[model samples]
Target: MSPPKLVFYVTVVVFAGVVIFTRDLLYLVRTETRYGQLDQYDHAVRNKHHMDQANLKILRAKAGLVHDENNIELNLTLRFQVNGGENEVRQKLKYVDKTVKTSKKEAASQGEITFETPSLLTLFTTWSGKGDVNARTHNFTLRNWARLKPEVNPVLFIDDGYDATVAQRLGWKTHRIPKSSINGLPVLKDMFKVIKDTYKSTFYGYANSDILFTSNLVETLVHVYYDSFYSDNTTLVTGMRTNIVNLTEEEFSTQTTLLNAVSTRGQLYMTSAEDYFIYAAEYSWSDMPEFVVGLIAYDNWLVLNSRYREDHVIDASRTVTAAHHTVREPDYQSHFRENAQYNKVLFRKMMQFHVEPPYEKGFTNCIDKYTEFVDKKIEIRSRKLEDPCLF
Candidate 1:
């Protein structure tokens, strides 16, 4: 009934519909394959930053202090370095009143910084080479932090495995907190109280122990942590978006469907209880790191509870947190062997290594792994240092 031109137009429209329909059907098949949604997420996380690399000793909780009958102002260091090479290279250090700074670029790499205040909040690594770095902003809370001296430590926390002579010989102070925590929460609470009482503030960073600094991670964190640029009203900081890390709106809807089945939050720990739930690591069993979703939920809660923007970031780089809970050769041989070989990597790369318990007395301990990883990285960089583009 239509003219020739009209008929041609209709044919064009119908063909377009078929093509779009076919394309969508293909996409549906691809997304539902065994790899499914997670494959896409892996690529997103891996690209955040090249492998790389905070001292703000401030906490402002209403908690009291040890000095005052005192809550707990403390020096917190996560012993993370496993020195397995030649002899121990103890470098010279310079100490200022409230500030413990190294004389040279690498001086702080293998030294300790002590805050005499009963309350100090810091995220320092166990290994000297791990690097103590924080922005000058955090140091604003220090009292005369720039008094110069050699090897100054008021007191240090000693674990069951610390080299006792090092702190003693250094003329530093040391007090040990015997127990560790789930997600470092217990130790941190004490540390938080210690700092808060001294500083009369409650600024805290529940950060990773492996976070070493070649550059100032503290500076970057302060910039990002307080900057209002990336966020808007009613939004939360999820940091970098990782693959499969953030569920789609639909996946979230289904997660809700499954979440309701749990009677208690702790019951959600078992994957069998619900695949949607992931429980705490041994140390985190009680308080837990809060699930990715829960972290976001907490952000919302924090936003609601206070007018302040307590931005929490889940994404940093491998250098910031290469692996959580050490992954061993056996693990690599099994879980990640074919990761790169796949057309689409199946699992999202893990960020931090959870320290496995029942400590082993060997060079291959978890601390050793981090040092080895760092050394290898340094070696690789040294080789490429000549390239003008690298600088």
Candidate 2:
């Protein structure tokens, strides 16, 4: 190539890069602290200047959002993830998605993001009610969930371990449950049927249990997700995630299938490992939620969403926390031993919850975060329903 031609092309490319860099740099100046916290993240974080510039660019991609400051009230919906069979899991996912879009769109000038409550829609099983060995944990979880969102209708899938009294306490209706293997995971899709059969309301949400929210979390997300300004539909819900690397077919069975699919936004992002296993729960010989969530997406039962958030403790020793909530202290890690296999994946994923964060950061802190996250969701969901009066 001639020297003159080569020089001209080089100048054009460098100039373009500079223009892009300058715009993002200005953006970082606007939200530096927010982006700085995430700077360590490979996907979410970058230099404050870089992210500001990127967010600015992304905003510009939208037609009417270039410089709009209009405030809009978008509807907020809350739902839960149901682990069951292929058909059932798919059904619930569709229901939740439909609910979010249809119910929440009316109030948005831009739009609103629905904040999902994690256990709002758990699969009611009798492992706890059935008095089975595994029921011990299920019983605690079921009872707790029942207390959290009594308004959400329950379709009891397996009635083996739980009784009428327990069911009534949790405000669950008796469901004709499909027989399940003690060792198998439940289907996530079936929850859809229960919702359709019960609530005339189609809109709801899906969130995790262990999260707490900031005062502005639900409010902010609602505004942002629905904001006509934002073009991306799939929100990276989890700020932190514990990724899974080597998985037994069982562990990643359900998750791998779904996260591997294409979304409206294109590309199936594994929101986090939790959802993956959640898909494989059905037909699962082992009782694990991971497979249930993973498989549902893999089966194309649902779109692989980009957004996700972490609420629960993924690990016990790291001082780094999972959410922005208050916590009590836990010195338990000193006496507790971590599963070697678990730690390897956790460090790899760069997120460890439930487990203690770095030195001196322990259980109490997690408890605080949980308290805040849950309260935040309840507040947001309640306000959306116009019944903060209930609390």
Candidate 3:
């Protein structure tokens, strides 16, 4: 039990201790390797899930199932992919195109869409009965108006018991004028009241039955409607007529023939002769006098009243070419007619009752502004008032 026995026992104990420590180290290494592999697999699965979500979004956008905001972003991304030579993205865009066409067709078939446009302006007139020189002239006028765009609605207010065969044939709306008149002539204010009540239009116009307008009439109104100057105010648009003597029905058969005749034979009338009046829907005719149409003083009085109200009184002479067809020279002495005198008397009465003393003269010069074509575009220019009566 001396030195030799003690050494052998110590060596055995040391070797056993070394073996146990080595086995424990190997176990620790194996556990760490398994955990690392599991972490790598989880990361790969998470990346695959993120990629699937992105692909679904793109597919939804291509199918037009995404909201507009998302579609916008998707469109930009797809466009980029298209530009980057991605043939698959290009095919997706084509599919989206086909889907859009199908969707539109489905909506249309279901009555979910409409393409009908509403009329923007209503042009109206009153004329004498058939079987007269006036009737022939009115026929030409109505036909000329029928050639205008559908946006301009043409209506003929037939005098009570008068035939509207010509207007009806031209597809114009026909209605009987109220029996209210002075000396068998329809009152201007009453006619306007009827027009306002019966029709829905952005603008209303009353042209003399003999007046022929070019397509510029509609173009001028469109410009005025969008003009910022008239945005906050009611407007009264009037212009001088171009008189063409003995303008035959043959001469007015087509717009081109009519314009050629006008360019050669037409003479611009004096500023005092305003044959047509166009006013905005917001214009008030409540205080207008019961002056009969086709009479003197009434048109003048209207211009004066519009100016008095601080409305936008625009002289459209430069833009609108209103052709007045005259079979014979107008009788200057017609101012002495009974209806003319009646209008004058009515004007005096309206001035006495409604207007202040030192009444302003009612004329084209009283207009606050005038329209003209600048570089082929309509422009509103302030008119310089040289007449003291206008101020």
Candidate 4:
């Protein structure tokens, strides 16, 4: 309680704060400084610096590899649609049957041909809203993803009321699931099962249809495949997405051109969240709750649960550019309001219990930042670090 003692304590506290802040500042400087030419978008450039910094920290966390710390190991395997009219469903079924046969023949020709599935499969659930932009974005996305990686098969699952003719033309396996709904969200648990049973790939990825991807997405997946630290099947992959509006189909004629466009114009927003999810096909999800896509907290809960279950969940923002091409937000209808309510209730439980996923240690905010939970509570600085050093 003496004056001298008080002064000494304050000095020590200030010095410690200065040390932490200065160290963090140096880290940002090293990672955010761009070596290449800047772009026309100033905000985008600044945002990209923050993004690149966060991504660098994430990549550096797992022994200098991109990974999240989770103890479980499921084996990384492969095997691998949605809505539309009943006719679209029928077309999808026919396509699936034909593709399965063709895949068998291809495997047989390669000699042993023991496994009946491919290495990877990607699924996109979307409804082409009443606009050319959405449809055009879908066209570019499907086309780009179809040829994104030759080894990985991509399928388009369309919701009812939307047409899949364009997708069919792109040679993507287009399927329409039954229009059953829970909370106005198409039942995805069963839908996921159907795709898994049919394609039987080693890995399965679910991405929004409006999200444009380059070849780097597949190459990043390949990087995950080769990662020795979290190479096991129990790994779940997701990443921060850059939002780029009004990108035309012609801009994406090739991966090189598309990536260049994204680099120059893509607005670097939405850090530490996910737009795409790629995971081992064998991971169990029979109990996944009903979640309408594009609604708030649906994706957040997935990250929380994955962390709770000790699965290796990674943010591959640095390695993959999962670009969101549309500018318009979804209409807020009564049903959407209901979904938001469900999200609120669910998130409350997630926050109350303070579910700590592996490797995260004390952090609980799964929305953004690789934050550290100190004193069993989230501090202001916890939110400040774009990529807080886990050490």
Candidate 5:
């Protein structure tokens, strides 16, 4: 080859190498800086300066205030006259963004950041009884959950006497679960079948109407599915929830905004495992009781039944944020009425006698942390079925 031609080729190769090296260096620097900022924020939380009452107000407002059981509410006001005023408030809120971003990055690294689930998820909710805030809040919640995995197909099963139009407007595959005065609510097991028969997705989730899910749910679900790490087809994943009273329509526009608000204003309280249930579509749970969902102990019954069947019940609190929106009073009160109370007694009886199922062997439980489940059939301990710890 000619010397001039050889020189030209060498120069081109050197330029390409330089560009690649520069790009990689910049990426490394950005990653390190982000991690460092995250560490700094965590350290700042522990600093003595953070404990000052003046600074405490700002932190409480940004992180959310929870009243003690004694009804003493934590005063969280951003209107305090700090030295920097609005600019300081802005920085406080900005820290929330950093905290959330840091959390996302850590979670992504843990799960290896796969954006899609191997198979489409078909998630559904059952709703009955209503107030004005019901549809608006639920629509917002459903859409937010859907965006977590755009591949998911959502279904809404409205019981008799409930409006289906609102759900249809939100793009859910709407259907009516038949109600009967004789048996009361529709059969829970049959409803599950209906959802599976209607939508042909690989996985199915049944959540209560008021429950709201964050993006972490589907991400964790997908991660569990991608590697077949949770359990076999019979596995059920559930989690603890955070409760927020009086959520408005304005906060529903963006997931980040709602989540940050939840982090700041919401009270973290976990109810029974019945609030959420996710499992493979092919799961065949037999002889679910005629006890309707709204009945006091029905949700608990579902958990016990899963245990009886020896199915894997995973507590996914580490990755899921189940947000409950409590906006009305009477609506929440009717849940503890006469019929529901009776059902609770019945549930306790069943548990005491071990009358139902007669399956002596208990199911394996994976609670709190996420781990890849191998095929070894390892013995997992049984946690207290009703115990809900703060996330």
Candidate 6:
């Protein structure tokens, strides 16, 4: 009886040991399988990330961007069609990670690539220092121009014995007028010629001293700088102004306040009266007439001449806010000033030489191209003008 009991107990103990061994073996297999699955998932995720990064690099390269591996920055290399279409500009830009995700979409939708950056431009002006209102308005506009600093270089053209202390202190370069009319008014052509000789900038411009510009001026120029329309041809950029009546220096103490006033209190001036003129540096002023500044006919004639030369003219009225403060009404008496009539005579003479009918050219309505915002992006579009004259 004792031998049989020993045998049964030995069999039960061996079966129990087998059972425990099999359970441990199954547990080891399940753990190995779980770890293998996790490893496969990690490899797939890493592969996807690598592929995305590679695609981003390819897209950036196609968009004229070179990525810096160490700093994660991008450098832009642009080929401009200025001065005979052979110039290249290289600029470094700070990169953002989100740019990688949207670059492809933007390139696809815009039909052209654009980058936001400060552009180099030169602006000049001449004003009389005769009245308190004139001084105040000039100071306000000059200060507004200051906000475009480090990007736009402003020059003040003064006649002999004119005070330029404020403009100099505000970082504007002061230059004596190269030539003036018999009445001591600066000649428009001479001012432009001096600017071309003195400054090296992507674009050059002249504005009435009372007109205030926002950063949109710089941004618009940057857009025009990259557009294919102006790539191969010299471009003349002009725009209408917003007339703000009795605007004071205190009304535009800050940029926000100024923009608010422009939107809420200002009225768009007639397109016939353009307050500013921006043109590429390549534009030629060789045959420009000796029309005087602060006069009406010169502005219109400048546009006419640019068009007659077959250069591109863009009306940037939609994108640029040129605020003109009406510190005082234009003197009707001054319209008959000898210097003022000088401009009109010059314009008529120019029209006669060009063999074009009078009153057919030299207005904002004659511009054949314009800059407009499409989906918050600047785009160049062709404008159809009625009664358009052939240059």
Quick one: best TM-score, which candidate? 6
Model 5 TM: 0.58
- Candidate 1 lDDT over 1-391, as tens digits, reads 5699899999999999898778666644653552333334433323322223211111100000001111011122211122332223222211111122233223234534322222222322121111224222112111111110111112234354445464445443334543343322124335333322333211223322311111112212222222332222222211111112221233223212212211111010100000111001111112222222101122222222212223222122221211111112112222233222221111111111211111111101111111001211210011111111111
The lDDT of each candidate is: 0.23, 0.28, 0.64, 0.51, 0.52, 0.66
Query: Which digits, one per residue and each the tens of the lDDT, describe model 6 over residues 187-273?
Result: 887888888788777788999888897766765676776566764237889977766778766678865567666655555555556
Native-to-model Cα distance after best TM-score fit, residue 385 in candidate 6, in Å: 1.9
**Model 4: per-residue Cα lDDT over 1-391, one tens digit each:** 9999999999999999898778667644543442111222434433543556666354233211222222111122222211221111110100011111223235323321222344444555655343545556666677777764334567766656667776677667766754445444554556576677777665777777678765445444544543443434577777666666677666677655666566656655433235777777777776566665645555656676776666766666555667777755323232365545664355555552332212122122232322121222111121332333232
Give one digit per residue, the lDDT tens place, for model 3 in 121-198. 678888666445576687788888887635567988775567777677887888777655666777777778777888
lDDT (C-alpha) at residue 255 in model 2: 20
In each prediction, how many residue pairs overlap at the backbone (N, C-alpha, C within less than 3 A)? Answer: 50, 104, 0, 17, 2, 0
Which pairs clash (backbone N, Cα, C closer than 3 Å) in model 3?
A: none
How does model 5 fare in lDDT? 0.52
lDDT tens digits by residue: candidate 5, 1-391: 9999999999999999898778667755664664465446544543423366776555533322321222121121111122333212211111011111223234333422322222246777676644434666666666765554334567776665677665566667777774432235554666777877776655787777778765445444544554333454677776555667787776666656566556565554423334777887667756665555655556656666766566666666444567778775224453655465545555546653332321111211224233221221111223443211211
The digit string of per-residue lDDT tens for model 2 on 1-391 reads 9999999999999999898777656644543543343233423411222346676345222211111112112133333333331111111110112223333344322322222333322333323234354333334334433533422334355445446567666676566444332234344435434434454321222323222111122323333234332233222222222222222233222322212210011111112222211111112112112223112122111211111122121211011111211122212221244332333233223333222212112212111121112211211121121111111
Lowest summed lDDT across 10 adjacent residues in model 1 is found at 57-66
Candidates in order, TM-scores: namely 0.27, 0.31, 0.66, 0.59, 0.58, 0.67
**Distance (Å) between predicted and true CA of 235, model 5?**
1.0
| Cα lDDT for residue 20, candidate 1 | 75
TM-score of 2: 0.31
Residue 250 alpha-carbon offset, candidate 5, angstroms: 3.0
lDDT-based ranking, best first? 6, 3, 5, 4, 2, 1
Q: How far off is residue 72 in model 2, in Å?
A: 25
- Model 4 weakest 10-residue run by lDDT: 87-96
Q: Which stretches of candidate 6 lie over 4 Å from their true place?
A: 1-119, 130-133, 329-339, 353-357, 388-391
Off by over 4 Å in 3: 1-117, 352-360
